[model samples]
Target: MYCPFCSHIEDKVIDSRLSKEGDVIRRRRECFNCKQRFTTYERVGEIFPMVIKKDGRRERFNREKIFNGMKRACEKRPVSIDVLETVVGDIEKKIQEIGESEIPSHIIGKELMNQLQKLDHVAYVRFASVYKEFKDISEFMSEIKSLAPQSVVSYEQNPSKTIDGVPL
Candidate 1:
């Protein structure tokens, strides 16, 4: 494997193990030139279907896109990278299970939102705000309230308190 830090093509695998789901292999490699270590994942490739955009254009499915969106939503939250990876893996498994050649972007968006909603409320709201494109504060607050029925009342009482009740 090529070393990402120095671009050298020589590396030694320090560890190799199957992921929790046993579908992917995780490898920890140490670069021969830089002595730096990095992790990589090994999984079956070229099995994902094409993604159909809202404009009716078709493109190859990209897991990095999903990872980026998830990373942005999980920003400043307690969400971990491993959690995001597992979420992406789960989504990929779901899509592959559908056994279709083409899938709509909205379907992917809905699936992502559903997963995020269960993972972290703040991340879910962040992703929803962008994916759904709320027009005003009312719509945003409505979405938030739907996620947590008690949020509206609690927020009204203490506007500065965070979701965990830590005073801001």
Candidate 2:
């Protein structure tokens, strides 16, 4: 595997494991040239269906697009990178498992919101604000209040509290 940092072609697998319920292999690679470490995931390449946008336009599915959005919502929060990864993986897997040639963008957005809701309330609100396009502070505060108890529960229980740390 090529090292992502140095672009070195030669590398050794320092670790390997299954990810996203064993659908993919997550590998930790160490570059022989620069000794830099990176990760790679191997999965059965499937032809994902085109995502039909709300505007009635069709586009190819891109997991990175969702990941970037999730990252933004999760920014400056206790959310962990691994949690974002897992959420993205779950969304992708759900789409692929449906055995369809096309999927709606709304469904993808809902799935993202669902995953984010369970992961972090703050992140969920951040994402929802943008995804739902709140018009005023009331709308934003409603979302925040809706998330309060759950956020408190999560905060107290998991003080180390990283988004990528636990699926909950």
What C-alpha lDDT do the candidate models reach, one value each? 0.77, 0.75
Clashing pairs in 1: none
- Which digits, one per residue and each the tens of the lDDT, describe model 1 over residues 94-130? 7777667877877788779868977999999999999
**Residue runs of model 1 more than 4 Å from their true location after superposition:** 1-46, 149-168
Inter-residue clash pairs, candidate 2: 79-163, 80-163, 80-164, 83-164
The estimated TM-scores of all candidates read 0.63, 0.61
Best by TM-score: 1
- For model 2, state the Cα shift of residue 159 in Å: 29
Which candidate number has the best lDDT? 1
- lDDT for 137 (candidate 1): 95
Model 2 lDDT per residue over 48-126, tens place = 6778998999887766689899999999999887667667767876777766777778778877887888798778888
Q: What TM-score does prediction 1 earn?
A: 0.63
